[model samples]
Target chain A: MGEVIVITSGKGGVGKTTSTANIGTGLAMLGKKVALIDTDIGLRNLDVVMGLENRIVYNLVDVVENNCRIKQALIKDKRYPNLYLLPSAQTKDKSAVTPEQMKKLTGELRNEFDYILLDCPAGIEQGFKNAIAGADRALVVTTPEVSAVRDADRIIGLLEANEIRRTHLIVNRLRADMVKEGNMMSSDDVVEILAIDLIGIVPDDEHIVISTNNGEPLTGSDCQAGQAYMNICKRVLGEEVPYLDLEVTKTFFQKFAAIFKR
Target chain B: MGFLSNWFKSSESSSDIAKNRLKVAITSDRAICSPELMEQMKNDIIKVISKYVDIDTDGLDIKVTRTELDDDSGTVNAVLASIPIRATKPLRR
Candidate 1:
C-alpha cells in the first residue's frame, strides 16, 4: 500500500503546485513509482507545470464521474519514467467531485503506486476538504512572509481538526541574503511560529522560474531549489536527510575575525 | 550621536515587526472570538456586577488572551476579567 500525501497552503501563489511537481519528480527519479493528482479543479496548473498539458485526455472529474478509467486519466511524464499526473478538470468547479469520491480515488491509486501526491487548491473551502479527505499525511507549503505564515497556521489548525496527524512544513522561496540582514524571516522563525516539523527549505532561485517556464523541473541538476526538493523527497521516503545550510556564507574578513575571537 | 541613535532606533527591521504582529494575530484567530463579541461580554459582565455593588466600569479590564503550555500540556485559551468594586450594598437596603 502507498502513502497519500496532500500538498496544501491556505493562500494562493505560494508554490504548492511547483512543490508537488518537483517533489513528485524527485521521488520518481529515486526509482519510486509516483502519481500526482491535481485537485485544484477549476484552476488546474499542475499539468502545465509538468509540461504534460498537451496529453491530458481525461482529468480528475472524468475519473470521478466514471466517464473514464483511472488509468485513462493518468498522464505519463516523458522526462521521468515512473512519474504520472492525474490532471484536474478546467471546465468544472470544485463541486464536480465530492470528498467521498476523492477518498475513493486516492484509495484506488494507493494500491498502484508507491506514493500519491495531491496538489490542493488554495483556501479552506470545499476544495481543500476534498483534497485532504484520503491523504495519510500533509505538506503545508508557506513563504517567509507574514500573510503566508498566517494562512499556513490556519491550514495547520484545519488539518489537525481533520485528524491528519503527520503534517510537516516546507518553507519555500527563502532568501538567505535578506534573512542575514534581518529583513526577512528565517526558516527557524517560520518553524517556531507554525510549531511543526520542518521537512524542506527551498531557497529563492531564478532557476525555478526558468524550469517552470520551460515545462521542466530542476530535479537532475545542481540547482539549489531542485536539490531542496530532492532532499524533501528523501525525507518523505523515511530517509534522514539533513536540511541544507541556507545561511549566507561569511566573508573572509568575518571568518578571520571569528578565528581571532575564538 | 543623538541623531544617530534615533536613526538606528527607527531602522529596526520590519521583519521583527511582522513576526510580532503575526504572533498576536494567530493567537487571536485561534481563539475564534470576535472583538465585537468580547466588547459585548465585557459590558454584560459590568452590568451584572454593578447591580449589587458600586463599581468602576471605566477601570474594568476584560480581555481574551492565550496562555502558553508547558512541555506536557497544551496551550489554554482563557478570558481574563478584572472588575473593581468600590463598595457592596446590603440586599435589604
Candidate 2:
C-alpha cells in the first residue's frame, strides 16, 4: 500500500501548492510513482502550478462523481512520466466532495502510486476535512510570522483531534539573515513551540517566485530553494538527510574588498 | 553615559516577542475549551457546590489555564476556579 500525505496550512499564502508541486515532482524524479491531488476545489491552482492546466479535461469532481474514470482524470506530467496530477474542479465548491468520497478516492489511488499528496486549502472548513480524510500523515506548513505559527498550532490541534498523529512541521520562507539578526524566528524556535518533529525548512529564495511564474517546480533545479525541496523529498522517502545550513559566510576576499568601501 | 545606559537596558528582540506570544496563545488553543463551554462548566460547578455551601456566585472566577506537570516535563490544561464561600450549610441531625 502507498502512503497518503496531506500538505496543509491553516492560513493561506504559505506555499502549500508550491511545496506540493515541488515535492511530488521530486518524488517522481526519484523513480517513485507520485500522484498529487488538488483538494482545493473552486480554487484549483495545482494544475497551473504543475503546468498541466490546459491538458485538464476531467477533474477530481468528475472522477468522484463517476463522470470519468480515475485514469481519464489523472493528468500525467510531460516532464516526468511517473508524476500525475488529479486537478480539482474550478466550478465546484468544497461541499461538492464529501470526506467519505475523498477517503474512497485516495484508497483507490494508493493501490497504484507510491505516494499520494493532497494539497489542502486554507482554514479548518470542509475543504480541510476532505483533504485530510484519507491521509495517513500530515505536513503542517508555516512561516516564521506570528500569525502563521498561531494558525499552525491550531491546525496541529485539529490534526491531533482527528487522530492524525503522524504530523510533521515544515517551516518555509525562513530568512537566514533575519534569523541571525534576531529579527525572525529560527526553525528551532518554531519546532520548540509546535512540539512536533521538524521535517525540513525552506529558506526565502527569489527563485521560488521565478519558478512559480514559469509553472515549473524548483525541485530538480540548482537553486537554493530547489535543493531545499529535494532534501524534503528525501526526508519524506525515509532518508536521513541532514538539515541544510542556511548561514551566510562571507569569504576573506569579500571581507577584504568591503574594507575599501568603508 | 549613553552607551552605558544602552548596555543596561533590557531590549527584547522581535522574534523573542513573537515566540512568547505564540507560546501563550497556543497553550489556550490546545485546551480546546470554548468560552461558551467554560461558562457552562462554571454554572454546573455552582449547581454542585451550592448544596454544601453558599458561594458568592457574582465573585466567582473560572478559567482554563496551563499547569505544570508533576514530572516537571511540560504543562497540561487545568481548570482554575476561585469560588468565595459566603456561608457553610448547617449539618442535619
Candidate 3:
C-alpha cells in the first residue's frame, strides 16, 4: 500500500494547501508517482494551485457517491504526468463525506500511487477528522505566532488522543528579522513549546502570494521558501537533509571583518 | 564597571553573602512563614530536644530553602531532606 501523508493545522490561512501543492509537486519532480487529495470540502483550492481545476469534472464527492468512478474523478497534473489530484467538491460541505468513505477512497488510490498526500482543512473539526481518518502519518503546520503554536499544540494533543503517534511540525511564515530583534518567537522557542520534531521552516516570502495568484507552486522557482518546502518533501521521503540555519553568530573576528570591509 | 562587577562577583565570600541575602529575601516571596518563625522553630526544636533525646544544641540549624514548584492543589511544596551538615565548631564565650 502507498503511504498516506496528511498536511494539517488547527488554524486557518497558515498555508496548509500551498505546502501540500508544493510538496506534492516537489515529490513528483523526484519522479515519484504521487496523488494529491484535497480533503478541504467546499473550499477546494488544490486543483487551482496544481493548475488542474479546469479539468475537474468528477470531484471527490462524486466518487464517494458512486456518481463517477475514482479514475474519472482523479485529475492528472498538466506538468507532471505521474502526479494526480483528487479534488474536493465545491458545492458540498465537509458533512457530505464520511471518514470511512475517505478511507475507502484513499485505499483504492494506494494501489496505484506511491504517495497519497491529503491536504487537510483547518480547525480541529469535522473536516480535520475526515482528513486524518485514513492517514498513516501527519505533518502539523503552524506559524510562529503564539496563537498558531497554541492551536498546533491542541491539534497535537488531539492526534495523540486518536492514537496517531508519528507526527512532525512545519513552522511556516517565520520572519528571521523579527526573531533577531526579539519581536518574534525563535525556532528554539517554537520547538520547545510544541515539543515536536521540526521538519521544515518556511520563511514568510511575498513570492508565495505571487505564486498563489498565478496558480503555480514556488517549488519550481529559485525561492528560499521553495527550497524549504522541497527539503520537507525530502524529509518525508526519509532523507536526512539538515535544516537551514537562521541563527546569527556574533564574534570578535566577524566584527573586525565587518569593520574592515565597511 | 562591567569587568569590575564581574571581578567582585567571582570572589568566594560573595557567594556566601549572596546565598545568605537570598535566603532572607526569597523565603518571604515563596511562603507565608516569616524569618522569625524559622528562627523560633530552630530554638524551640533545640530546647524541646534538650528536655528529651540529646541533640547537638549548638549544632542545630534550620533554614528555609526556596523550592522550584508548587503542587497541583496550589500549596507550599518543600521537601525537608536532611542536609549534609558540617559538625558544630567550638563556641567562644
Candidate 4:
C-alpha cells in the first residue's frame, strides 16, 4: 500500500505546483515509485512544470470519463525512470470531476506506487475538495506572508474538520535576509500560527523561476531551493533530516569571527 | 538621538505588526462567535453584577481571546469578561 499525499494551498501562486513537481522528482530520484496527479483540471500546469507537456495524450478527465485507462493517462517522466504524472484536463472545469471519482482514482493508484502526490488547485473550492478526498495525508503549503499564513490557518481548520488528522506544513519561498532584517515572517512564526508539524522550508531562489520556465523542476539542479526540496522528499520518506542553514550568508563581522576561530 | 529613539519606540516593524494582527484575527476567527453575541454576553454580565454592587458599566471589558497552552502544546480560546466595580453598597442592619 502506498501513501496518498495532497499538496494544497488555499491561496494561489504560493508554489504548490512547484513543490509538487520537485518533491515528486526528488522522491523518484530516491528510488521510490511516485505518481504525481494534477487535480487542478482546467488550470493544469503540473505537466508543463514537469516538462511532460509534449507527451500528454490523455488526461485525468479521460481516465475518469472512461475514455482511457488509468495506465494510458499516466505520463512517464523522461527524466526520472520511476516518476509518472497524470495530467489534468485543460478543457474541462472543476465540476467535471467529482470527489467520488477522485477517491476511486487515487485508491487505484495507491496500490501501484510508493507515493501518490495530488497537486491541488488554489482556493477552498470544489477542486480543493476533490484533491483532498482520497488523500491519506495533507501538506499545506504557505509562504511567509500574513495573507498566505492566514489562508493556511483557514485551510488547516477545514482539513481538521474533514478528519484529515495527519496534516503537515511546507513553508515555501522563505527569504532568510528579509527574515533576519525583521521584514518577513520566520519559519517559527508560521509554524506557531498554523500549529502543525513542519515538513520542509524552501528558500527564495531565482533558480526556481529559471527552472520552471525551462520545464525542469529545481530539484534536479544544485540550487539551495532544489536541495531543500530533496530534504523534503527525504522527510516524506520517513527519514530524519535536519533543516539546511538557509541563513548561511553571514555579515562581515560574523565571517571574520569564523575565520579567527578556524 | 532622543527623537529618533522615540520615533522607533512608538512604531513597530511591519512584520511585528503583522504577527500581532494575525494573532488576534486568527484567534477570533477560530472562536467563530459573532460580535453581537459577545456584546450581549457583556451586557448580561454587567446586569447580573450590578444587582449586588455599583459597577462601572462603561469600564467593562469583555472579549473572546485565545490563550496558548503550556509549553507549545496548543491554544484554547474563551470569552474573557472583566467588569470593574466602583464600590459596594453598605448593608443597613
Candidate 5:
C-alpha cells in the first residue's frame, strides 16, 4: 500500500506549494515512484512550481469529470523518471470535486506509486477538507510567525479531532539572521509551542524565489536550505538526520566568538 | 508638574504596549480567558479573597505569568501572568 501524504497548512502564503514541489522532487530523486497531486483546484500552482505547467493537458478535475483517463492527466517530469504530477484544474473550483471523489482518485493511484504527495490548499474550508480525505498521514506546514503558528495550532487541533494521528511539522521561511537578531521566531520556539514532532526546517532563501521563477526547487541547488529540504525528504523515508540550525550562517568571526564564549 | 511627574502620568494606552501580546493570544489559543474576563476574574478574586485577609485591590496582582499549567496527562509550563487588582474604598453608609 502506498503512503498518501497531504502537505497542508492552515494559513495561506506559508509555502505549501513550494514544500510540495521540493519534497516530491526529493522523494522521486531518491528513486521512490512518487505522484504529486495538486488539490488546490481552480487556483492550481503546483504545475507551474514543478515547471511542468506546459505539459499539463489533463488535470484532476478532468480525471474526475471523465474528460480523460488518469494516465493522460499524469505528467512525467524530466528531472526524475519515477516522479509524476497530477495537476489540479485551473478552470474549476474546489467544489468541483467531493472528498469521496478525491479519496477514490488517490485510491486508484496508490498501486502505481510508492508515495502520493498532495499539495493541499490553504485554509480549513471545503478545499482543506477535500485535500485531507484520502490521506494516510499529513504534513502540517507552518512558518515562524505568530499568525501562521496560531493557524497551525488550530489545524493540528482539527487533525486530531478527525483522528489523523501521525501529523508532523515543517517550518518554512525561517530567517536565521532575523532569528539571531530576535526579530523573527526561532525553530525551537515554533516546535515548543506547536508541541509536534519536527520533520524539517526550510530557511528563507533568495534561491527558492529564483528557482520558483524557473519552476525549479532549491533541493537541486547546493544551498544550505536545499540540503535541509533533501534531509527532510530522507527523514520522511525513515532516515535519522540531525536537524539543521539555520542561523545567519555564522561567519568566521561569529564562529570564533561562539568558540570563545565565557 | 515636573518631567518626572508627567512621566508617571502617561495614558494607559502607552503602558498597554509594554505588556506582552502573547498572553492575550495564548488565552484565546487555549480558549479559556480574555482581558475583559480577566478583569472580571480580578474583581471576583478580590471580593472573595478579601473576606478574611486584606488585599491591595489596586496593588493586588493576579498574573498569568509563564509557568507550568497542570493537566491530567503531564505538566507543561504556560503563561504566568500578573494581574494587579487595586482595592476600592468601602461604601459611605
Candidate 6:
C-alpha cells in the first residue's frame, strides 16, 4: 500500500501547495506512481500550481460523493507518466466532504499508487480534518517568520494529538543573506523550536515564482530551491542526502576571523 | 558607524529575539493557558494560600513556563508561582 502524507500548515501562504506539487512531481520523477490530492475545497489552487487546472473535469468531491469513479477524476500529468493530480472542487465548500469519505478515497488510491500526497488547506478546520483523515505521516511546512513558526508548532501539536505520530518539518523560503546577518531565523532555529526532525530546507528564490507562474514544478532544475525539493523527495524515499548549503560565502579574512572566534 | 556599533553590540539579533518570542509562544500554546485564565488561577492560588498563611497577594507572581525533562527525554509545561509569605498562622486543633 502507498504511504499517504499530508503537507499542511496552520497559516496561509506558507508554501504547502507548492511543496505538495514539487514533492509529488519529484516522486514521480523517481519512477514512483504518485497521486497528488488537493483537499482545499472551494479555494482550489493545486490544479493551477500543477498545471492541470484546465484538464480537471472532476475533483476530490466528485470521487468521494460517488458522482464519478476515482480513476475518472484522476488527471494524469503529461510531463511525468507516473504523476497524477486529483484537483479540489472550486464551487463546493469543505463541508461537502467528511473525514470518512476522504479516508475511503485514499484507501482506494493506495491500491494503485506508491505515494499519495495531500495538499491540505490552511487552518485547523474541517478541510484540515478531511485532508489528514487518511494520512500516515505529515510534513509541517513553515517559513522563517515568527507567525509561520508558531502556526507550524500548533499544527504539529494537533497532528500529534490526532495520533499522526510521524511528522517532519520543512522550513521554506529561508533567506541565506538575512540569516547570515542575524535578521532571519535559520532552518536550524525553526527545527529547534518545532522539535521535529527536519526533512528539507528550501531557500527563497525567484525561480520558484517563475516555475509557479509557468505552471511547471521544479523538476531536474539546478536552482537551489529546485535541488532542495528533489533532495526532499530523495529523503522521503529513505535516501540520505546532505542538506543544500545555504550559507553566504565568507571572505578569506572572515573565515580566518571565524576560526579565532571558535 | 551604525554597522560597526551593531557588530560590537550584544548578541540581541532580531533572529534571537524571534526565537525567544517563539519559545514563549509555543509554551503558552501548548499549555493553552490564556492571560485571563492565568489571572484567575493566580487569584485562586492566592485565595487558597491566604487560608493557610498570611500571604501578600499583591506580591504574588505566577507564570506558565516550559522546562526540560531531567532524563533528556523532552520538555513539559510548568506553572511557576511565587507567593510572598508574611506570617504563618498557627494550627488550631
- Residue B20 lDDT in candidate 5: 33
Candidate 2 has which clashing residue pairs, if any? none
Candidate 3 docks at the CAPRI level of incorrect
Q: Write the per-residue lDDT of candidate 3 for residues A174-218, one digit (tens) a residue.
A: 888666644577666777656678999998988898888888888
- Candidate 4 chain A: worst-modelled 10 consecutive residues by lDDT: A157-166
TM-score of each model, paired residue for residue: 0.81, 0.81, 0.70, 0.83, 0.77, 0.83
The CA lDDT of each predicted structure is: 0.89, 0.90, 0.79, 0.88, 0.81, 0.90
lDDT string, candidate 5, A148-262, tens digits? 8878877877776566767899999888766654456777777767777899988888889989999987785698779888998999999999987665666879879998895
* lDDT per residue (tens digit) for residues B1-93 in model 2: 545754775798778988988876675676577656766778999999998899999999776554546885544457778999999999767
TM-score of chain A of 3: 0.92
Q: Once superposed on the true structure, which residue ranges of model 3 sit more than 4 Å away at CA?
A: A246-262, B1-93
Q: What is the interface RMSD of each candidate, in Å?
A: 2.5, 3.5, 14.6, 2.7, 6.8, 2.7
* lDDT (Cα, tens digit) per residue for candidate 1, span A1-262: 9999999999999999999999999999999999999999899999989999999899999999999999999999988878999999999999999999999999999899999999999999999999999999999999999999999999988887787878899999999988876779889889888878899999999999999999998875797888899999999999999888877688979988999997
Model 6 residue runs over 4 Å out of place are A250-262, B8-10, B36-93
For every prediction, compared with the true complex, DockQ reads: 0.35, 0.41, 0.03, 0.39, 0.08, 0.49
Cα error of candidate 5 at position A147, Å:
1.5
- The CAPRI classification for model 2 reads as acceptable
* First chain TM-score for all predictions: 0.95, 0.96, 0.92, 0.95, 0.94, 0.95
- Which stretches in model 1 have alpha-carbon errors above 4 Å? A250-262, B1-11, B36-93
Cand. 3 Cα-lDDT: 0.79
Chain A of candidate 2 scores what in TM-score?
0.96
Which stretches of model 2 miss by more than 4 angstroms? A251-262, B1-10, B34-93
Model 5 gets an lDDT of 0.81
Count of clashes in candidate 3: 0
Model 4's TM-score against the true structure: 0.83
